[model samples]
Target: MTTDSLDLFADQPPTPPAPPDDAGAEAGDDGTLALDRYAERAYLAYAMSVVKSRALPQVEDGLKPVQRRILYAMSEMRLSSSAKHVKSARVVGDVIGKYHPHGDSSVYDAMVRVAQDFSLRYPLVDGQGNFGSRDGDSAAAMRYTECRLTPIAELLLAEIDRGTVDFIPNYDGAFEEPQLMPARLPFVLLNGASGIAVGMATEIPPHNMREVAEATCHLIRHPDAGLDDILAMLPAPDFPGGGQLISSPEAIRDAYASGRGSLRLRARWRIEELARAQWRVIVEELPHGV
Candidate 1:
């Protein structure tokens, strides 16, 4: 057997077989009912593993592993500031091989989503060739698409080499991993998040960068300001795709006061006239599931 397999077996302890189908098992000495504690413990361990490793976002970094890998892969490709674009296939291969260690299709899908301006209020990717659209169209094949990082991404990744964050050994100890991201902006609010876990979940809405920043500054200056004061600075969520926040004025006030609530959003459309034709296009829309 391989060394790794031997090690795995060595770490495991043998379990006792259960009583035969017709046999009545005796209770433990302490009068406790017989139970498969080992199995229960194993199941609980697996659940906690999934929750810690997948569902919950790391508050320090404001990103999951896949998201971090995508940004780093873009930086490694030298696609930050240069006009030269790399094929999406190249990016996918790099991320899968060097960082994400996941299927190429999923990595490519995330890449396209990050590039779509309509999906993100501030897209972190600058893509060429069809990267998909807000109407739920699939992006072109990796070979047909080209990509690079946007200026905002550049700012986020720049701190990686500056020793501002921590790095540790990866799962296999064959590579290093970033413990957290030194994000210049509050990206959690900028892009928002939605994730599910055992007995828990989170749903956050995207907000305008300018408005959020202004509100943050105001809060800093007047630490004791009430919810109304903060709401005065940030009237409502301003989406990049130019949409109206449809919640009642009172609803917004309540949300800010309670620190939680849902907001309604609607798309904004505009009509354009050409020399021989007229066209209607949606200029803006609220973030999905707002």
Candidate 2:
């Protein structure tokens, strides 16, 4: 052989193969477990819980779980529009103890929202005291406030005893709650809803009662009527706050057709003429949710 040169600096030789892995031992290690499968299942379960049981409102009744519980509890307590208003705390207690097994504040908040005219197109709870304000005021303590369901709410609960909806057992199986309310109107479109859930969300704008009623009647008369016919009766959203919907006709029509669109709403204002050729802008109405 020719004169061979010894390489002084070189990588170490590869180590011999380790002993064969024990299948049982490998399985015992957390690293080898099917983590992705378990994680996926857990994520899906939590997502469904948020979507179906909590965040989103049911299309049939337009009420979230908490809202539905509040209404049903009030109905059970005979807190009708004609009846005298009861302390909000009492209703909250009934709701928590019977139908909803949640915190007192959350239930009370939902009840307050149902009462606030600025929040709902049609106030469901006829609140006697300070429920809240459009200017960002928190509602008074539940103990201080009094509330009874409004006449509009009566429509939702009137047919409960007549088997208009199915009932299911409450959290502890101590009570039964209706699956959905027997709504006389399509409350989903009437009051509108905005909710965020797993991978999806909904933002339905409130419509005028008369327009919605007319559209409902039209649909009932002609089940297969086109969107244009329906649009003629229900032209655009009518928010609780009276403001101008400045969106063009084409945009409005597109929104109705595609089921996804944005609306441009501006506060109603007018220029007031003052002395010495001075003028000032006075805002009459604000956009909804402002």
> Which prediction has the highest lDDT against the true structure?
2
Relative to the unseen true structure, what is the C-alpha lDDT of residue 118 in candidate 1, on a scale of 0 to 100?
75
Clashing pairs in 1: 241-284
Top TM-score prediction, candidate number: 2
- CA-RMSD of model 2: 15.6
Clashing pairs in 2: none
Model 2 over residues 82-103: C-alpha lDDT tens digits? 9998999999999989987777
Q: Could you tell me which 10 consecutive residues in candidate 2 have the lowest summed lDDT?
A: 1-10
- lDDT per residue for candidate 1 within 202-247, as digits (tens), equals 5556777887788778878989987778777777765557667789
Deviation from native of the Cα of residue 196 in model 1, angstroms: 3.0
Instruction: Give all TM-scores, in the order shown.
Output: 0.75, 0.86
Error of 1 at 120 (Å): 0.3
Q: Runs in model 2 with CA error above 4 Å?
A: 1-33, 276-278
Worst 10 residues of 1 by lDDT: 1-10
